[model samples]
Target: MQYDSISHFLRTGQEHLAKGPVALIFAEDDVEINTTLRHHLDLGFSKVVLFSPAAFNIAPELAEKCPRVTLESPRGEPMFDAVNAINDAAIGVWLYYCFNSEYLLYPFCESRTVGEMLTFHTEERRDAMLTYVIDLYATDLETNPNAVSLDSALMDRTGYYALARNDPDNHNHPKERQLNFYGGLRWRFEEHIPADKRKIDRISIFRAKEGLKLRPDFTFSDEEYNTYASPWHNNLTAAVCSFRTAKALKFNPGSTFQIQQFKWHNSVGFDWHSRQLLDLGLMEPGQWF
Candidate 1:
């Protein structure tokens, strides 16, 4: 089903909004649209919705399967407004959002479904799941000028770090369980990237509630939802192996010429499995074992 606008989707697409664990995909471009939808559908989302401009060429079969919302401008503020509206309409549902060329990876995701992970998380009283946006790019930018080749996708195995999240309202003291995570392509090419867009941490998986708003920084209106874990112990964390950064850096004229190749001594082939991310300390199983 296709909706002409976000408001149209909210008004008449309530059936799709009825279920929990819905995957909200915002397509910045046509890059890997089909594969992105396929990955999340296979991950077991109850409903998968695509927000893309009409110009995008979506596969006929996928077009028939997923609800597509016609979004003239799908980035920045418009994207956030759409999400907030959907959150209001779909209260109590588990929601996850990402762009094209991004795939979600949780501990034991290979064997277990995303629904199973969320069930376990809900049992732990978690309202949101923190995800690291690990940058993926092709080793040879010459062959794939866009820096997006899933077959040759490489990611930084190291360089990830976290710092205390300070609260402005609380006299600069660190937040209880929240931290500002950084690294990946953003950290390495900080000069080209804007300061606000550099953080790799995103609370991508969350529960929708009344008055819940997704902030510009990719955090949330609720402080607890921004936390990495519960007060008692560490909870499950996930990683989103993405080519978004790679695509941006390579497409932007300012940085495109400067970056000859994304590969480096620390670069490693992404195995597309949970175990590799776990081994690299990119994500944690917490107490899910």
Candidate 2:
């Protein structure tokens, strides 16, 4: 189970700093971290780092299964701090993906390596990253049953821009409105925002270049290529940048950069982050589900 050790490193650590062509970072909360760690290790990423905000609850023998893995104490802003530390090291092409345990479906959706996907984008287009969507299910259900082939399921289609118009009616039906109204006035007010106004599907992939800094403002825009979004609202407006970006923006580990209140367990963060990336024109809609 040496691979289990590697899998643990990938799932629960931070970003892999070991010298390599690529480094994979998995920021996870609660769930069996080893499952995700093992999943990504099979995806061809040799160096992996896992970051967790809670104490390791697995049995001592199971926890010790991953020797090379580095465990860091949980902090208030573990995600931001871990990412910053990894980017500071400036390893080769950094591909960052964050999701809850429920989102990752294996043998992974595609049989392709992360490096292979990035190769599709030229060096000049490094800022343009690939995006994908996770079909959330209450049980073990799939939205697309025809997804027997990873090629058909995971291919990067064209015309997938992030910040486009969305159907408000589709998102806010009478049932949704009723739930919000019954909940409180604040919930109703939150529902009043337009669907297109909310950013949803995007991911960040790039090589950390010199002088690049993560916008300390942490908020991002829904407009194409607008990297200046603030992270204070309920929207997914934070920017994922290199350690250099964190340093430039003067981001402290304990400081709160993005603030919003929502039910954390139901995949709202992933949905919001994806939308923000699309709205800012940093990602294409077709890349996502």
Best by TM-score: 1
lDDT, residue 247, model 1: 98
lDDT of 2 by residue, 160-226 (tens): 2232233365683332101110111112222443333223333344444443443322211222222
Tell me the lDDT of candidate 2.
0.33
lDDT string, candidate 1, 116-203, tens digits: 9999999999999999999999989999999999998999999999999999999999999999999999999999999989999999
Q: Model 1: runs farther than 4 Å from truth?
A: none
Residue 44 displacement (Å), model 2 = 1.3
Which residue runs does candidate 2 get wrong by more than 4 Å?
1-16, 19-28, 57-76, 102-109, 128-135, 140-198, 215-289
- What TM-score do all the candidates reach, one by one? 0.99, 0.44
Error of 2 at 90 (Å): 1.9
